[model samples]
Structure formats: structure tokens, C-alpha cells
Target: MQLITAHVMSKHLSLSSFSFRAPQDSPEKAIPSRKLPFQTFLSFNPKKPLSLKTHLPIMQISKTLFVFCLISCLSMTSSQEQGATAYEMLEKFNFPRGILPQGVRSYVLNTDGSFEVYLDGECKFGVEGGYSLSYGRKITGKVSFGSLRNLKGVSVKVLFVWMGITEVSTGNGELDFYVGPLSASFPLSNFLDCPQCGCGFNCKDIVSDS
Candidate 1:
């Protein structure tokens, strides 16, 4: 009787253990599994294929490119306008007797449309005339008028001449001067020489000995 009872108890325990294990292998009881959230987010959804998340990088690149292009275009336009202003000033003055010496070359137009001339890496002069002739460095100068009649359009012309002088080549020892129209001319003497006696004749009236 004891042996029979022990056999029956062992059979009952084995049956219980098998029943618990069987459910674990069933599809319904298994742990739920699917793609990760991040991976799913990256994939183009068939229902909403044009989602912002899916196209985020492309949008970012497009925005960046647009900003870059806009900046580049604005910079180019600004530069062109500055150049045009300088040219108009030059035309207005019409340096008829090209004042800059042969070796002097133009550099660039300043913001104020003044011409700058350089000789041996040094500033030579800045010319501006309103009702009179004003000549000196962009920082300092004196003004004189041959006649008020000559002063017509004088301001614009003088500004252009100053701009032209400022643009002259500094590497070369040559000095460039502007006369009346856009005619660029080179004088026969050094820039520092007396205007009364040297190429300064064009610049003499405005230039002072002191």
C-alpha cells in the first residue's frame, strides 16, 4: 500500500509540472515582441509616408542650403552696389586729364565713393571739391575754388577723384592723380615733389607747402 501511494503522488506532481510548462511554449502566452520604437519611427509609414521624422535630415539640409545661398547672394549684391557707386562717382567727376601717374594702379572703391591713391605703400591724397577744390589725405585737407562756376557738380567729382586716388597701387613707387574727366594721367614726377614745380601742377592749387 505504501509503494502504491508513493507512485500515485509522483504521477500527480509530474502532471502538474507538465501543465505549467506547456503554456509557456504557447504563442499567446509568449512575450510580445515588435520592432523598436526608434526603428519604427525612422521607417516610412505606409499610412503617413511623408512624416516629419522620416524626412527630418532632408529638411534640415534644405534649410541650411537655402540660408547659405541667401547669404552668398546678399554679399555679392552688396559688393556690386559698392562698385557701381564708385563707378558713378568716377563718371561724374570725369577726370579729363588722367591725374594718376603711369605706374599707379587702382585698388578698390571706398564706402564713401572716395578715390585713394598710394605711392610706395603710403597714402598720397584725397580730393573733394564742393564750391571749391579740397585736397589732402582722407583725414586732412584744404579747399579752394578757381571759380564758383567751376564748382558745378564739384562735390561729386571731388569725391570720385578721392576714391580713385585711394585705389591706386601701393606696391609701385608711382603716384596717380586725377584731373577733370575719367581721363587717368600719370605725372612726370614723384608724388611728394612740389606741386608748383612737379607733376603736382594738377594738384598744386589745393596742395600747400606746409
Candidate 2:
């Protein structure tokens, strides 16, 4: 009975040792679970709401800049159109008159911007006008002229007129008119009207015969 008991006790101790060693030597038991990084966890957290307050100001500034650029472009286009129109009118009317007629005259621009022209002592035309420069400078005036008269019987009269400006420069500021015999081959400056010149005589001979 004692021998049987000793054999059973030794067998029980051996099985206990084997169970302890099996866990320490196993590859699956040695492997550890991978843990996620803190940064990665924050980025993927679906329950957290992201605040975009810092970006709002930048977006607003960009929008403001876009609007400013658009306004500047529109202003430039309008100024160019006005300048073109003014230049066209000058070329069509003023430049062709190489010399002003004896009776054709321009009124001196005044502080109150009013002036008059007379033809044969008669009131003819007048104008009241105002102008501004691109830089916001202002010029205002009115001009009136009388009937234009010559020995040739051609006469013209002007009515009241006014002009406004956005800007002024030396190159853009003159008014001119022409008057002479239409049939004469020579420029009117080459001949002078005589004291007795009348509508019945040739303009060329009237000056020489006098």
C-alpha cells in the first residue's frame, strides 16, 4: 500500500511542472496585442466634433479681396470709355479747324464758369458746363456766343452749352472753329478782307483791290 501511494504522488508532481512550463514556452502565449497610438485615436474618433473657427476669417479676407479687384476693374473700364468718347469728339470737330475765324472766339473760363460770344453785336450762343478730373478735381463753366458773321454771307450762331469733366490736362483742353470762303484755293490767312468788302465781290479780289 505504501509503494502505490508514492508512485501516484510522483506522477501528480510531474504533471503540475509540465503545465507550468508549457505556457512559458508557447509562441501564441508570448505574443502581445498591438495598441493604437494616441494621435491616430484622436483623428478617427467619430463622436468628436471638429471646430473650423480659425479658417472663417481667412475665407472672409479672400472674398473681400475678390470683390475689391472686381470693382477696380469696372471703374477702369468706365474711365477708358469716357476718355475715348471725349477724344473722338475733339478729333471730329476741333482738330479739323486749323485756324479760328476772326469772329469765332472762346470765352475765358471764369471762377463761376460763365462766358459769352457775340456776332455783329448780337447775342448768339451760350453754355453752362462743369467738369471733373480723375483725381476728383472740378471745373465748371458756361459759354455763350453771338451769330458768326463774314463778308461771304455765311453766318453761324451758337446756343448755350455746358461741359462737365472728371479730369483735365493741358493736351485735352481747347475749342476751335473754322470760317472762310469755300471756293478759294488758298488758305484764308493769305488774304485779308478789305474795309469795303461785301458779299457781291470775289473774296480774293476784294483784299487786292482795296
Candidate 3:
């Protein structure tokens, strides 16, 4: 009876102390950690600077593509328009080249008859009508057969106040420039040659045909 009780007590102690542990090479031990490098994608770390090599895939390239297309279209259009000089184009529309001043830096003419003219800077001069004319660096308008309408960036001085030139008409050997309700007519021969800035057509530096 004494031996039986001792053996039972030893068995109870052994059961309580025993713990089941898997082998060192078990499948659970071979699995990787949950906190991996790739899991924290595009995450900023105060101690580490950004690296494009790892985060390039997440960038938005749509805006860059759109801007590139827009610029390419404009360049192609500008190149196509350059086939003809601005003055020559004016002649083709039945308007004299002299209507525009000298030193045109560039111009863009659209298929719909809308055009933009660019100059180095503002140009101001006096015409025979005793009126002072000023031309802005950028001029925009629509040109049609024998007429320039919707004119902007061209102005005239009347009674110490500057008034914009709204329209121009050419026909019957006469040229008319409109300043509000008033219009001035000049002979077509006056515009045979473009006038130079600060020196009407009577430029002293120019040599005569003789």
C-alpha cells in the first residue's frame, strides 16, 4: 500500500511538469516573420531617405504624359504654320504687307482665320492722319478678305486719350482705320512700303531707289 501511493504521487508530479515542444526543424519554425520589408510599401521612415528604385511603381505618370502630348501638338502646329512668312500670308489675303510694322519676331496663324502676332516689344509711331499709333508686343485678331476685324493690342491717341483700333478696311485703293465711331482714310500708295519705327516712311538711313 505504501509503494503504491508513492508511485501515484510521482506520476502526478511528472504529468504537471511535462511540456510538449516541436522539433528544432519543425515547419512552424521554418516560416518567415510577418514583419517583412515589402509589406511596408511606400512607407516613409524618419531615419531613412526615399529611394525611387523601390517606389517608382506607385508614382502617377498620367499628368506627365498629358503635358508631353500638349507640348508636342503645339510644336507641330507652330512648325506647320512656319511654311509661310507673316507678311507673305497677309499678301495672300489681299492685304498689303505694309499694314504691319517691321521687325515681327514671330506669328501664329490658325486655319479658322484667327492669328497672333508677336513683336520684340511695344512699337509706337505717328501716321499722316496726325494720329499717334501704338502697337503692343502681342497682337491678336481675325483677318478676312480685305479687312482686319476684332483687332486688339493696337491703339491710337485722340485728344490725349488712347483709343483702340477696332477694325480696318482696304478697298478701292483706299485704306480705312477705325477708331471707335470715327474712321480715317489714307491712299493705298502711303503703305507701299512698311514704315520703320520712330521714323515713318521717311527714314534718313534708307537709300533711295536712285
Candidate 4:
């Protein structure tokens, strides 16, 4: 018959390629397709594993670095007390801008050194052993290094009463002057200059001295 019908159609195409094989992977279906992308990245109460988009950018970068380090430490403490004055902070604590007099007009020290001095009112005068002092348009206390304590608006003039210098200090070279429990000393070249509020320092060298 035509060569036995082409050998039974070449043995039916080699038994359809060994009954079509190919599939193989199996460790229980490849571990649920590799745990389906780690269970869609959990966080649905998986014991609260940090997920407010990971603590909201770490609390917004720690509150923007604590408000930019508190406005750069308050602008470097107001640029180091701005124009610093009070007679250059009483020569930086050693004191003696003639113990303050000549219409100060304004002040305030405080960094625990406490102060306040202002003037242009309530003054008084006379100095040089005849004493007299006075000066209360506001003055206050607490200084250090060479010292000055409790003070409050000045005063002096003993021998005719009116006493309350409260405190002042220095040492060896002298310049004491307290009040209660009495004290006195002087001679730090008797306060360089700066007195006139009602005309003091020897009448500013007695007018026309020629």
C-alpha cells in the first residue's frame, strides 16, 4: 500500500515528543512564589514595625535640628551684648569709672553680675575727704572681681549723717567703703575722674584756672 502509509506517519511524530514534558520546580510550589514579594512588605500591625513612612522622616529631621539650634543660640547672644557699655562694664569688673556719676542715662548688666545705673536726676556732689556722695536716679548692686555688693542707689556723707554706701571693695591698694558694721579706706588714686552731676570733681578743675 504506499510503503505501509509512510510507516504509519513516521510513528505519529515520534509519539508527540515524549508526551510534552517541561515543568519541574516544586519545593511546595517554590515557597509560595518566593513569599510573594515578602508578603507585600508587611506593616498591617505586624507588631508595629515602624511605618508612618518610617517615623515621618525621623520627626522631620528632629524638628529641623531643634529650630536651627534655637536661632543660632539667639544670634550668638545678641552679638555678644551688642555695643557693650556701662563704662565698658566698669572696666570689665575691676570698676572705678569714678564709681559712676556723670549722667549715665542708661545701663543694666546682669548675667548674674546684676547692675543697673541710669542718671540725669537725683545727683549730689562733693568729693575729696569732705565726702558727700549721693546719686540716686537708679543704681543697683552686685558686681564682682574687685567687688561691690547689695548697693542700691548710693549715699555717703558721714559726720552729718546720711549713710548707706552699702558696699564697695578692692584691697591692698585700698578703696573699701561699706556702711553697716562700718568701713572705709580710699586711695585708689581716689577714683580717677567722672564725677560732675551737680559739679563735683573739684568743680571740673575750678573753671578758669590759668
Query: RMSD to native for every prediction?
Result: 24.3, 31.1, 21.3, 26.2
Q: What digit string (tens of lDDT, one per residue) describes model 2 on residues 1-210?
A: 011111113443332222112245456443333333332433432234533354555567778777777765544332123444322322333232221222322222222223232223212121112211110111122322311222122233222322222121112234322323221122323222211112221444556888
Candidate 4 clashes between residue pairs 3 or more apart in a chain or in different chains: none
lDDT tens digits by residue: candidate 1, 135-204: 3222211111110112211121343443322222222333333344443323323333322212233555
What TM-score, over all chains together, does every model reach?
A: 0.25, 0.21, 0.60, 0.26
Model 3 over residues 90-160: C-alpha lDDT tens digits? Answer: 88888788788888889977656778999888888878867788889999998888989999999988879
* Collision count of model 1: 32
Question: CA lDDT, every prediction?
Answer: 0.33, 0.29, 0.73, 0.69
Cα lDDT of model 4 by residue, 173-207, tens digit? 77898998988798877787777866677774677
TM-score of model 1 (CA atoms): 0.25
On a 0 to 100 scale, what is the lDDT of residue 42 in model 1?
52
Among all candidates shown, the one with the greatest lDDT = 3
**Which structure among the candidates has the greatest TM-score?**
3
What is the number of residue pairs that collide in model 2?
32
Ranking of candidates on TM-score, top first: 3, 4, 1, 2
Q: How many clashes (backbone N, Cα, C below 3 Å) per candidate?
A: 32, 32, 0, 0
> Candidate 2's C-alpha lDDT?
0.29
TM-score (C-alpha, index-matched) for candidate 4: 0.26
